[model samples]
Target: MPVFVKKVLAWGSLAFLIYFMAFRPEGAAQMFKAIGAALMMMAQGLGDFLTSLMT
Candidate 1:
């Protein structure tokens, strides 16, 4: 189980690295900014769904 978790984390990090390097290499600053924006949107959508279920 530990080994599986480690492999999953490693693969996930590697995927992020490859995606940022290959597809978004205009600049590190901008790449991180886009990632943050995407995460915020994802979080907001998730929160909205959860709140709707409660209400």
Candidate 2:
């Protein structure tokens, strides 16, 4: 994409996301919780794999 178009999309998405999250605080909380869980699971899986590899 062109630089101008990329900038427009970045700003547009930021504005839309801010509006959506602000409109539904509960939804934002749930979304963050899900994201945190996913990160935790990924980290645990990675650690296990590395430990097994080292062993």
Candidate 3:
């Protein structure tokens, strides 16, 4: 809620990401791949639900 807290979180997250990417590029790639798979699955599930509602 506070601007200071938001800035801290943003910078902290950026730093962590930079560290992870620099130290473990393979792990970062796998993490992104897993996240993409999860998002795809969620989108497919939502589409199925909407189709079922229509029929």
- Estimate, for each residue in 1-55, the C-alpha lDDT of model 1 and write its tens digit: 6999999999999998888778778775687889999999999999999999999
Which parts of model 3 have CA positions greater than 4 angstroms off? none
Local distance difference test values of all predictions, in order: 0.90, 0.94, 0.99
The top-ranked prediction according to lDDT is 3
Clashes of 2: 0
lDDT of 2 by residue, 1-55 (tens): 8999999999999998798798988988898899999999999999999999999
lDDT of 3 at 22: 97
Estimate candidate 3's RMSD in Å.
Answer: 0.8
lDDT of 3: 0.99
Instruction: Report the C-alpha lDDT of model 3 over 1-55, residue by residue, as the tens digit.
Output: 9999999999999999999999999999999999999999999999999999999
Write down the RMSD of all candidates, one decimal each. Answer: 5.5, 1.2, 0.8
TM-score of structure candidate 3 = 0.91
lDDT, ranked from best to worst: 3, 2, 1
Clashing pairs in 2: none
Question: 1 or 3, which is superior by lDDT?
Answer: 3
Question: What is the alpha-carbon lDDT of model 1 when measured against the actual structure?
Answer: 0.90
